[model samples]
Target: MKKILYAIIPILAFSIIFLNMFFGHLVFESETQEVINKYSVYVHLLSEWQSESKNIIFDVTNTWYKSDKIRNTNHVFDAESKEYNSNQLHEINGKSYVELKHEFSDCQEEWQPMLYRKAVDTVRHEIEYVQGQQLSTDPSVSVYPDTENENYDNSEQQSKIKNGFVQFFPICTSKDTTSYNFSVKTDNKDLGFDVYFVSSSDQRENFVNSKFDYYTESGCYGQNKQSYSGTCHDIKKDSGLLVIFPDDLKPWTTKVTVNLYENN
Candidate 1:
């Protein structure tokens, strides 16, 4: 009887732990996001970027990404409010480009205008930020409404808050260019059913699959299981660096330092 009891204890523990881990990934399946603005930054080639002479300017003033739960039938929890606002700087042959700069701010505050310089040198290879020309004047830009309580609940219904860290988990990390399709078909359990790839051409494809690691100055946040903590992630390869956020922590107004790298 004692041996049977001991066996049952292990089984119960496994079940409970597995259930929690599984629950961490649960909210993603039912999530439906409306990407107001998204673009790809090609990081593999450095030589091509250095030779660029065109002066790239902002196309749109503000771009954001937000996700909502389609399964919220009662409309209890407010729409998942997560966004990163940045200017779109395009790379054209006639343009003179310099630094790839980034700034972090939340929804309520007046974000500072990010400054860019033409003189730059770096340790890594190279990267170019593709942006839309209509950023400031674009009529499609939508404002994300605030919620009554910004605090998230800790319950079984809560899943991992990716914190805008979504990566292509398939073959994109292995090569310079990888083409895969995400279908919104409910029957396919491997690929998610919430977000579907709508762009048919690779040039217009806003979704980029790369791995990254993030950290804050105060050590408030660091690398997750899915991210690479080394000098470089999936630089020239396809979906190599899979960045993941903390499962236990909910969204609070916090800032993080994002690093970009390329190979020599």
Candidate 2:
């Protein structure tokens, strides 16, 4: 009886392990398919000052979630059925300007613009900044209207808003590594910064069954104890650390650590 029981114990344990593995794999595969079915490009609005100074106050506040990186981010915006309108920014003098833009991806390459706005949504695969636009000399400060009134437009009673925001297009890739750097040269001293290269992984075998690149940059935007947020797409990496200095201080430096977050 002892010998029989021992033989049966190994068989029973093996059966349990097999069942768990099989079910887990099936569940993962199902999830992956769903994401692909809903893939589409989305327009994500970002303020240059918010990203640079690290003072991004917005969060998951809007009814819809818009992310350029994540799949099925279209829940944030709708060009069809006219679900929501008037997604624009206000100016200082009470005028309104629509800082509209577009994104291009395999998922949303065919989407067209609507009649309500001047520009329709488009796509650009890489992280390319719109050329010829001016970059703020004072990176520590962000320029935006103090109040939010949705109905106002450009007229005598309208607000005085200017085009100060920069438009960036996110590029998706399977590359193993990516990098960006920043530097400042002053009359009194010269200082430089580096965002070292890091690794990326894709653990979602249940979804696309492919790897996504991860990237990181420290102090690339600005320093003033600000906050910012954006979507990371299929890849994963730390947003980074924030640091601030006094106005009188001349020189400061720090390194950004980057690592990839793969699917598990």
Candidate 3:
């Protein structure tokens, strides 16, 4: 009897030790995996934020170029005299070209600092929230504002038209077909204008020269109104141009707002 009891005691002790070690390893592995998944999510969020910041900077730079072009075309200055043509500098909301340029420069200077601060705040908040909650490994699950699901892209530009015509080129970032909504509102709603979306400069010239009887027949999307709101989906290239001219061939000034949305 004594011999049998000693053998059973040893077996029971071994079994207890083995069971404890096995369960401890499983718990440890689960914790490690959880941490890894959380880290992956954090990294993904940071990458996405960085990409968005780059896009913002790119858009701002492009806008600056476009605005500069419009200013040069409308506000012609005598090279020798260093004098701006008073007739060409039309004021909108009492803001002249100089004032607008100054404001734009200020905005450009602040963008980087604002973006950096936002990135830091967003990451810190996310880290705290993640530590208290079970986060999914899916990269799409993010606390930051989802620009894709919301406003894909938006831009506003003000142009003073002295030649009775102006053209704006907007970039299409998406590889696939996307729809762009344009809202052209002017201070003078009674002053009607013509807006055309053409794929090429030749097409624009043809339209401007009245080569076609109808805009649709000319293979261009167009609107004739004092203020227009419409969508254009024929932008198949990396960029598209919007040509605007007053209906009465008179000088006009207006503000244009463009909103880009992608199809699901």
Q: Please give the RMSD to the true structure for each candidate, in Å.
A: 24.2, 22.8, 22.3
Estimated TM-score for each candidate: 0.20, 0.17, 0.33
The full ranking of all candidates by lDDT, starting with the best, is 3, 1, 2
> What is the C-alpha lDDT profile of model 3 across 20-68, one tens digit per residue?
4443222222211111110000001112121121110001111111112
**lDDT (CA) per prediction:** 0.25, 0.24, 0.32
Candidate with maximal lDDT? 3
lDDT of 1 by residue, 56-107 (tens): 1111122222323134333342223222323333332232223232322322
On the 0 to 100 scale, the lDDT of residue 59 in model 2 is 10
Runs off by more than 4 Å, candidate 2: 1-30, 33-89, 92-95, 99-217, 220-264
Per-residue lDDT tens digits for candidate 2, residues 1-264, read 999999999999887666544442232332221111111112222333222222111110011112333434333333552322224463311222233222222233222212111111111101111331112233211121112222332231111212121112122233332222222111112111111122322211111222312243432332111122222322223222121111121222222111112112
For candidate 3, give the lDDT: 0.32
Query: What is the Cα-based lDDT of residue 107 in candidate 3?
Result: 17
Clashing pairs in 3: none
